[model samples]
Target: MEETYLSAYVFKYGLEKALKKTGNIEEVTSRMIRDVSGGVRVEDDISPEGLIWIDGDNFNTWLKPKIGQCQADGSFKTVYQAAEHVAPDPYSIYPSSGKCTADGLVGADGKVRKNVI
Candidate 1:
């Protein structure tokens, strides 16, 4: 089965809340992973693949909302590390910020119109 992962930030709040309510962090995290993965799509910004195109600005604005964190510093630490933590998976927690070293999509003309980075 393909592995899946989520941004720690995205699951942090929900995990904390579930822990408070049920005192079961592992179960909560498992359920969250399942819920997030279900019905996911490529166009969805949080999808694992889509994350590749996410820039620091977009990560702070979009991904942070689902996780309830404030905008990250320009250094891009939070998002990049989070993505790396969950690798080889079709999960959304991956980093998409411009600071990442991965290459992005190219246009039909063979020019790399990849994400900023």
Candidate 2:
């Protein structure tokens, strides 16, 4: 969907701008631009019809819970809300194994406050 791409663009733009404040202005900005542009190109190359299948299947699998209470009045409440918002820290980005592990770059208010020792 166009909205999804637009949101990603806006988010990356803001994220890159924020990264500039941490030094390496040129490197960070250029790498972010290239990576985001490449991702967009790949997404754009997918046929619109392909999106129908991908999005349809993804919606059925992921969003089915949200629509469980649809009534004759066309109203429903959000039953499932994610308890945490996790975003990868750009400074320590790296690929991990299939186990979905991270290198301690995720930040949360309470998580940040905790100390191991």
Candidate 3:
């Protein structure tokens, strides 16, 4: 597959917070869903270093708490609590060239301390 470079911003508070603050989540999510479904091509645009232009829907999904109050009091504290389903899998992904590191996977959002190269 051809490589795609997305503008990235892996924030400590989480990308969803940034998206909500920017008021771009709805627009970004729409575009991302289309792209992931192969219905549209993702656009190349300028994004802040800590912010990445990727599948918004996937990122949104990744940010949600998997366990919620039902499973645990504060399961939402970390992404790993729901890594199996919450983390971005097929969308909002990193460059295929990035390697696995102690941080889990370099360049992958919400996984490492240094998310971008």
In the predicted model 3, the residue pairs found to clash are 7-52, 8-51, 8-52, 9-50, 9-51, 9-52
Model 2, 31-59: lDDT tens per residue? 45433332221123443211211111111
Please provide the root mean square deviation of candidate 2 (C-alpha atoms, Å). 14.1
Q: Residue 64, candidate 1: how far off, in angstroms?
A: 10
TM-score of candidate 3 against the unseen true structure: 0.15
Taken over the whole model, the C-alpha lDDT of each candidate is: 0.36, 0.35, 0.35
Question: Which candidate has the highest lDDT of all?
Answer: 1
Model 3: ten consecutive residues of lowest lDDT: 1-10
Tens digits of per-residue lDDT, candidate 1, 1-117, equal 102344443444345555666666555666654333322222344454343222222222223122323455632223333333222221234333212222333344555455433
Supply the global lDDT for candidate 1: 0.36
TM-score for each model: 0.22, 0.25, 0.15
**Which portions of model 3 show Cα errors greater than 4 Å?**
1-33, 36-60, 71-86, 90-117
RMSD to the true structure for each prediction, in A, is 15.4, 14.1, 15.9
Best by TM-score: 2
Q: Over the stretch 34-113, how does candidate 3's per-residue lDDT look in tens digits?
A: 33431122332432112223334433322223332434663333223433323446422545635443224444354444
Winner of 2 and 3 under lDDT? 3
Q: For model 2, give the 10-residue run with minimal summed lDDT.
A: 54-63
